[model samples]
Target: MKFLFDIFPVILFFLTFKLYDIFIATAVAIVAAIAQIGWLWLRKQQIEKMMWINLAIIVVLGGATLLAQDETFIKWKPTVLYWLIASVLLVSSLVFRKNLIKLMLEKQIVLPVAVWDKLNLSWTVFFLLMGAVNLYVAFSFSVDIWVTFKLFGATGMMLVFIILQVMVLGKHLKPMPERIQTVNEQDNLIEKIDNKAGKK
Candidate 1:
């Protein structure tokens, strides 16, 4: 499942850490993530830019952790990644005349550009806050606690943000254009009928 694929790396990272150590766990997680991404690509999934960015960040940070012989470098990985994505979101929302999220998402979902920009800006701030929280926990709390927070806290925050977004977008999510969902529904029905006939 899509949800499991996205989360497998995080789960593996924690498990590997418990089995090995921070540096080795990061190395193993990076390998596992690459395989996961490759599987998605082979399955013809839409590989978003954010996905690639995440992979690159992991590789770089993981490598840094190995080369430096410092777990702290790896510990800061989430903080860095969160803020970097947040910065991109903020810049796109502010300077781009068009909403970057809209450009990426419009082909899949229809909504006004203003609403798209609002969503982008909200994500930007949310990511920034997530990054700040990561930094605080990583430095202020024990490393073990920070790792637990990394595994659970970020995920919890993201899910809450998504649910909140759905509520916000509900008002703004344009009624599905007949050309989109309706047409797809018809195509699926026809395919099912053809398959049933073939089986008969």
Candidate 2:
């Protein structure tokens, strides 16, 4: 439910962005994020700290875009968002018993504490790397290429990362899904046939 609630604003942002400029899109996302916070409060859910961070970045970046009427401000927002999140992740690792990312995902994954720490470190490093890549693309590359890279290249890299992680953790992961595993009755059937022949 929380996950579904989270995507609602992203969907809204896509729609608004399609119909308007970068400034309007940024503003819409900010407004939607605020609404999401309100919804969380009303439902008695703990507001995510990352959501607050995201909100602050959106508000500041969106304000700048509006004030300057420059799409560059909005364009650079992704770089800012990535780096800021990465910094927070690293800081959390240093200050807390568990990194915040690990805490957020702990309920879904029943990994050992050491595994959690490893996961936290991996995510921290990945975010930092991604942040640097985003900064490079946004500031140094052509605007069209930067936008395209952000939309497509980043997603592709993330998918690859997930595949790599799964492969690396195959031994530690749960066995094949029950539905996909065939029952091993052949050996039993053969044993029963041989016993009947011997009795005869």
Q: Which candidate is the best by lDDT?
A: 1
Q: 99, model 2: CA deviation in Å?
A: 3.8
Model 2 C-alpha lDDT per residue in residues 106-130, reported as the tens digit of each score: 5555565677677777877787788
Write down the TM-score for model 1. Answer: 0.81
> Model-by-model lDDT, in order?
0.82, 0.72
Candidate 1: stretches off by over 4 Å? 41-46, 179-200
Q: Give the lDDT of residue 141 in candidate 1.
A: 90
lDDT of 2 at 55: 77
Best model per TM-score: 1
Off by over 4 Å in 2: 1-4, 95-97, 106-114, 140-156, 173-200
Question: What is the Å distance of residue 12 in model 2 from its true position?
Answer: 3.5
Ten-residue segment with the worst summed lDDT in candidate 1?
92-101
Report the lDDT tens digits of candidate 1 across residue range 8-114. 88888988887777777889888987987798789998886767887888899888888988788877788888899888777766676656677777877788767
